[model samples]
Target: MSVQEHRRLRELASMHFQSRCLHEACERGLFSELERSPGSAEELARRLHLHPQACRMLLDALTALALLQEREGLYSNAPIASRYLIEGTATDQGEMIAMYRRSMERWEKLAEALHCGHTPAPPSEPDPRFIHAMHCTASVHAPLVVEAVPRNNARRLLDLGGGPGTYSIRFLLTWPEAEARMLDLEPVVSIAQEYAEIAGVNERFEAVAGDYLESELGDGYDLVLLSNILHCNAPEGCQRLLKRAFACLRPGGRVVIHEFLRDGSLWPAVFALHMLLSTPGGDTYSESTLKGWLHEAGFGEPVVSRLEGTPSSVLVAARS
Candidate 1:
């Protein structure tokens, strides 16, 4: 390789350096400390009870990375750090970043994972930290679903494989008379019930727990929602699910799928890598594919609309 190419490889391999800087800073509450006020390296070392010289070096590295700024011999978190890294903020994504590290650490086995066609390392269950992080994330995305799915006194809504239940809650809240049933894994269903109760909509929210493949979805729904769930399964799985959704809907009933969709040609989509990391068989497909599925599932021509301010689109089909 040329000199520049060799240097680039070295920089990419040093990815762990950035991860450690973020993780240690978060674990030590360094961002929160700096948010209160800038402090000299010695003062920071005393506050955090760390070795003064080592602390100064780490702080300087953070400054070099632009996560922090140094002026007048005092250090402060950068604006982005102060806004998104500090704990207790509505947009605090530090826990998620930490969780990413936990997952990425296992991805060091990417070669083995690829050879075996499976993740060589398994993540644990009852991962409450990841669950809470997902809940926070879903809450952040719920408003978009509410705005995308048209609501006009709908009596019932079915949220298929809805995680966190935030989308269903948002729907119920937006349309007071609407009732929703959430279908998901048992662990996530348990959490969803708690969210439903806390939202004071438990009476209108029912939890159906099981795998979507084997369970039969009951009929007579005015609206069926498959929000951000279709991409988790393969194309055949999506087809089966769509047909089942059509069968469960009342005649002329609406079925809406909110998903991170690619364009008709399926290029320039950032979330294609997401499928590589998460779903084993499924990958992001073009809007035309989704429209074809909706039509093949015995629905009329579907209308695809792009959601504003999000990497998502809504495909609405009417049962014929």
Candidate 2:
């Protein structure tokens, strides 16, 4: 390979160094602290109980990463980090960073998992951290997705596998006349209710604690939303889930699917390997494959749209 290609490969290999630095910053609450109180490295180190020199080094690294800005020996969160890294902000993603940190161990076991066939069996109740991470990720994107969805006079909708119900809650915000029903595991649904209550949409939201695949989803709904749900299952299971979603919709009702579709992006291709490491049959699917599944499930021609600035895509199809 040419020297330029070699340099790029080296950068790719060591890119985890950057991620680890950001993860460490999240662990230490540095970004949030900087947002609330921008100060010199010495002051921050004293406040956060870090070694002075080490804190300065970290601060400089984060500044280099553009997540923080250093001005005249004082440091503060850059606009990007200020918006998404500060705790309790509407777009906070600290929990998501922690969740990714926790998943490192699982990713480390990829070789063994590949040798064997699957990762360890999932816990009966998912880690609460995972739910919180999903909430953070979803909350950041909910507005974009909720806007892209064609309301189609959807007075009622089903959020299948709606972890934390972030999208559903946001939908209620815009579609004031609409109500949302979310179905998931008991623990996840309980957490979803908490978020719904926090968003003040619980009155119009119903959280059902059950497996959506096997549960009885009442019919005649105006919409069904499957966000980040399809990629968790094998082909047969995905097809089955789509048919179940189909039956739960009324004639002319809409089904909206949101996922990290493989659309010639580096992220989705890598995410496919993540699925291989983490799931039995999950992978980043392509648009054609997804369209075929929707067609097989008896839906009319589907319209697909890519969410700007993200790998995730949304597909909307109608039941005739």
Candidate 3:
């Protein structure tokens, strides 16, 4: 291999190694320990009951990864790690990382999955761990979605496949007079209800439990939301769902889709890897596909807006 190619390979190996270390540290609560008390490697090893040499090497590696800092032999978690990576923090991304681990394992068989034109096994429900991951991730993204949607008190919003009612709750908070219905899987309804109650909008928000494709929706909603739902279905399923959403709206109603959309070109489909591992028939949709769907579904003036703080975008399609 050329020298540059060899250097890139080495860098990639190191990156994977560092990611593995982060996962291990997160699993073992090492970041939490450093948050409570900064210590030397020997001290941390004693506290964690790990081998001193191994702990030292790991801590040094983490320092190299910029996850920790060492000052005069004292090691401490970085601000980013302490604030967001620690277990008890609201922004703790451990659950998301753990979910990614499961998804990553499935994605390792990407070549086979693509060749078979099928996704790997679907996970059975009653999975508290996975559910928690979903809730945590939704909680992280809800605020952003609420901000992106056009603000209006008179708008009746429907959060289709709105897992955990995160976006719905945030919208209710943003506009107290706004009423929302969160439609999602039957099992996720309980989580959504809990979130609505916690957000103090249970009375205003209704939780609808059913499959989106089969559910009979009511009309007259000013805004219909489909956040992170399209990626769970195949192209046909998504097209059908969009058409269904379009039909369930009154004149001048708008459909809002919050998703990880790629640019017009299919180059660098980042979220494709996510769909490949997680959804049975799901795939990331492009802007053109979404715009075309909107047009075919009888929506006029489709506008795409990039979300402020995430890799997500909002597609607003208004009913004529």
> TM-scores of all models?
0.80, 0.94, 0.91
Clashes of 2: 0
Ranking by lDDT: 2, 3, 1
For model 3, the local distance difference test gives 0.82
Q: Model 2: per-residue lDDT, tens digit, 1-320? A: 99999999999999888999999999988988997889999999998999999999999999999999999999998999988888777778889999888878878888887798778765667777898999988987888898788887899999999999999999999999999999998878889999999999999999998887799999999999999988888788889989999999999998999999887889888888777776778788899999999999999999888899888999999998
Q: What lDDT score is found at residue 212 in candidate 1?
A: 65
lDDT of 3 by residue, 177-205 (tens): 88999887778888889878978999999
Model 2 alpha-carbon miss at residue 307, Å: 1.1
Q: Encode model 1's per-residue lDDT on 167-279: one tens digit a residue.
A: 89888888889999989877788888888888899999998887666687889998999887778677999999899999999998989998878774333253554444555
- The residue ranges of model 1 lying beyond 4 angstroms of the native Cα positions read 1-20, 36-38, 49-54, 57-71, 77-83, 88-91, 113-117, 120-126, 263-274
> What is the TM-score of candidate 3?
0.91
lDDT of each: 0.80, 0.90, 0.82
Model 2 worst lDDT run, 10 consecutive residues: 117-126
**Count of clashing residue pairs in every prediction:** 0, 0, 0
Candidate 1 local lDDT, residue 249: 94
Report the number of the highest-TM-score candidate.
2
